[model samples]
Target: MISIAAFYIVVSVLAYVTYAIDKQAAIKQRRRVSEKSLHLLGLLGGWPGGLFAQQRLRHKTQKTTFQAIFWLTVAVNVACLLSLTLYPYGG
Candidate 1:
């Protein structure tokens, strides 16, 4: 349990940093992080950080398709967490 928590924490922080970097890149008119990568991060349990970054940085919050996918990833991540908690051994 502790390990899982730590994994999420680390990944979340990384995801948040990725968003910030991508945002900065956008401001500079440079190459930005790919949407697929961002979605992958969220799928890997970083959705919370992704959400925070989206709101706090005011980035990627306006695209309807992106928001839809982001929310879906969040739901899937939450469902996975719940399943793990209820059946740690994969009953």
Candidate 2:
């Protein structure tokens, strides 16, 4: 539905924005966004932008754990989107 698409778009944009801020903080404050926060966002359907940030900002890609977790996040988000598309609620 349009709502779902909008949700995805909003979340992706938020993820990119969050990652950009995190990158800036890392440069200025010597700290990155908390792993929990990043994971939560990705899990909530921000994986694409998280991935973009990972590649663009080069943040959180060095750790093997993060790599695995990031992929998992992407997978989960995709699955959720698929479900939303295939099974409309009360339709």
Candidate 3:
């Protein structure tokens, strides 16, 4: 359980940094992080960080399509987490 929480912390921090970099790139008119990449991160249990970035940085909030997909990924990730918590192996 502790390991799972640590994993999420590390991944979430990485996702947050990635989002911040992408936001900076956007400001500088540089190459942007692909939407697919962001969604992948979210699906991998980084949705909390991605959401934080979205709200704190005000990034990627306007696109309805992206928001829809992002929320879907969040839902999937949460479902998986719940499954892991509820039915832990070797219980």
Candidate 4:
């Protein structure tokens, strides 16, 4: 459980940094991070950080398609987390 919490903390921090970098790139008209990579990070239990980044950096917040997929990844991540918590022994 401690390891899981630590994993989430690390991944979420990385996700937040990634979003910040992407936002800066967008502002500078530089190459952007792939949407797939962002979504992958969210699906890997970084959605909390992703949500923070979306609100703080104002990145990828208005695109309907991206928003839809982002929410889906959040849902999947939450469901997996719930399952792990409820069935810690893989019942």
Candidate 5:
């Protein structure tokens, strides 16, 4: 089994990569990071990074739907992380 630390590290890397891609897309005005990819990244615990990219790159911040979905994803991921930490293994 992968350790929690490893899992978070992977998530952070994914977040950074996705953020970079999204930023590039914005520079080219292409919107490369689709709604699907945004949702997927958020579900994977990368919403914070995604949100930062959105602000930093001035991308995808105006759509109400995107904001709603993104925040929901963040909440879900936070819930999952809290549960995982609060629950003991092999209980």
Candidate 6:
């Protein structure tokens, strides 16, 4: 449980920072972080922070396609997390 919590915490922080960087890049018209990478981060247990960053930074909230995919990734991550907790391997 501790390990799982720690993993989420670390990944969430990474996701939040990545979103911030991506937002700044967009404003500056610089190279942007790919949508796939953002979604991958969320799928890897960072959706909470990614969601927070979206509202907090007002980033990535305008695209319906991205929103749809992001929510799908969130659902998938939650399902995986529940499975790991409820039916831990080899138990």
TM-score (all chains, Cα) for each model: 0.93, 0.82, 0.91, 0.94, 0.74, 0.94
**Candidate 6 lDDT by residue in tens digits, 1-91:** 5699999999999999999999999999999999999999999999999999999999999999999999999999999999999989836
Candidate number of the best lDDT: 6
Candidate 1 stretches greater than 4 Å from native: none
lDDT by residue for model 3 over 1-91, one digit each (tens)?
5687888887788889999999999999999999999999999988889999999999999999999999999999999999889988935
Ranking by TM-score: 6, 4, 1, 3, 2, 5
Task: Estimate, for each residue in 19-74, the C-alpha lDDT of model 2 and write its tens digit.
Answer: 88888998898767788888889899888888888899898889899889888888
Cα RMSD (angstroms) for every candidate in the order listed: 1.3, 2.4, 1.9, 1.3, 2.5, 1.5
Clashing pairs in 2: none
Q: Which stretches of candidate 2 lie over 4 Å from their true place?
A: 89-91
For model 4 the local lDDT of residue 61 reads: 94
- Ranking 1 against 2 by TM-score, winner: 1
> What's the ranking of the predictions by lDDT, best on top?
6, 4, 1, 3, 2, 5
lDDT of 4: 0.95
TM-score of 3: 0.91
Worst 10 contiguous positions by lDDT, candidate 2: 1-10
**Ten residues in a row with the worst lDDT in model 6?**
82-91
Candidate 6, superposed: residue stretches over 4 Å from native: none
In model 5, which runs have C-alpha deviations exceeding 4 angstroms?
Answer: 1-6, 26-31
CA lDDT, every model vs. true structure: 0.94, 0.84, 0.91, 0.95, 0.78, 0.96
Total clashing pairs for each candidate: 0, 0, 0, 0, 0, 0
Residue 17 CA displacement from its true place in model 5, Å:
3.2
